[model samples]
Target: MKSLICLLFLALLSSPLLAQDIFSSKNTHFSFFSSSPLEDIEAKTEKGVSAINIKTKAIYFKVPIASFQFRQKLMQEHFNQNYLESDKYPYAEFKGKVLDDADLSKDGTYQVTVEGILNLHGVDKTYKEKGTITVKGGNITAGATFNIRIADHRIDIPTIVVKNIAEVVAVTVNALYTVVNR
Candidate 1:
C-alpha cells in the first residue's frame, strides 16, 4: 500500500498538462436583428467561430459581415454602406470568455459573463454582457444580447435617414461549437 501511494504521488507530480483549449466553429444557424421605425429587419450569418484557450487567455469569434441576408435590398444596402460598412469592415469579431469558472467537461446550464472587444465599422469597443451556455451531447451552445450605439462604432448616418436607423442597436449573438482536439 505504501508503494502504491508513492507511485500515485509520483505520477501526479510528473504528469505534464497541455493547456486546456476549446476549439469551436459557428453552427449552421446564427441570427441578428436590426429594427427601424420604418420597418423591422432580421438577418443571419451562417459562418462563425468560437475560440478559447485557457492557457493563453485567448478568445475570439468571427462572423462574415457580408453573409447577412435581409429581406429588403435597400435595407441591406444601407447596412453595408452606412452601418456595417461591410465592404471595408467585412467581418465582425468578438473576444472574451465565460466569466464564471465553468466546468466544460460536465453537462449543465451555466450563466456566464462575457467581457470582450467588439470590432465593427473600423472601431473597437469593449463590451461585457451576461449570457447562458449549455453543454449537451458534445455540443456547446451560447446566446447573448447587448446593445450598441451606432455612433460609438464610427458608423455614419445622414440626417435624412437618421430617422430610419435606430440610435441604439441591440445585438444578439448565438454561437454553436463542436469540439476539436488540438
Candidate 2:
C-alpha cells in the first residue's frame, strides 16, 4: 500500500496538467495620458513587471508608482507627492486572466478580453479591458489600452488644479514575454 501511494503521488507530480508554462517580462512598458481643456498630461515608465501562465490563462502585473517620468520635473514631483501619493502607496498591481481560448503556443494574433482587479492608490476596482496578443517564433507580445477614472481609485485632484487634469485617463501597456523555465 505504501509503494502504491508513492507511485500515485509521483505520477500526479509528473502529470502535464500540473506543469505550468509561465512567461515573464521584466521591462514592461506602461504609459498614461490625460487630456483636459487647460492642459495635457502624459507619463511613461518601463519599470513594470508582468507574468502570464499560458496553461491557466492567468496574468499579473506590478509597477512602481514613482517610476513614471513626466515631461516637466515639477509635474513629476506633484504627481508623486500630491496626486498618487507614492510614499503612501508605492505600487500598483493587477491580477487577471485571459478570457479567450486562443492557443498561446501557436504563432498567431488573438484578440482577448481580460477582466481583473486593479489596486491603485489603496483602492481596488474591477475592470474589463480588451487587448491584443501576438505570438511569433516562440515569443509573445501583449498590448492593451484602457481608461481609468480618477475618482474610482480615490485619487483626489484639488479643485485648484481640477481644470488642468481630466476626469479619466487613458492607459496603455505593452509587454514582450519569454518563456520562464521553472
Identify the leading candidate in terms of TM-score.
2
Off by over 4 Å in 1: 1-20, 53-58
Candidate 1 on 57-166: residue-level lDDT in tens?
34566676777878888877878876788889987777665667877656788887878788877789998888887878766677777788878988888998777677
Clashes of each: 0, 0
Q: Looking at model 1, which ten-residue stretch has the lowest summed lDDT?
A: 4-13
lDDT of 2 at 30: 99
Output the lDDT of residue 72, model 2: 100
List model 2 lDDT by residue over 56-168, tens digit each: 77788888899999999999999999999999999888888899898988899999999989999999999999999999998999999999999999999999999999999
The TM-scores of all predictions, comma-separated, are 0.80, 0.89
Q: Quote the lDDT for 125 in model 1.
A: 93
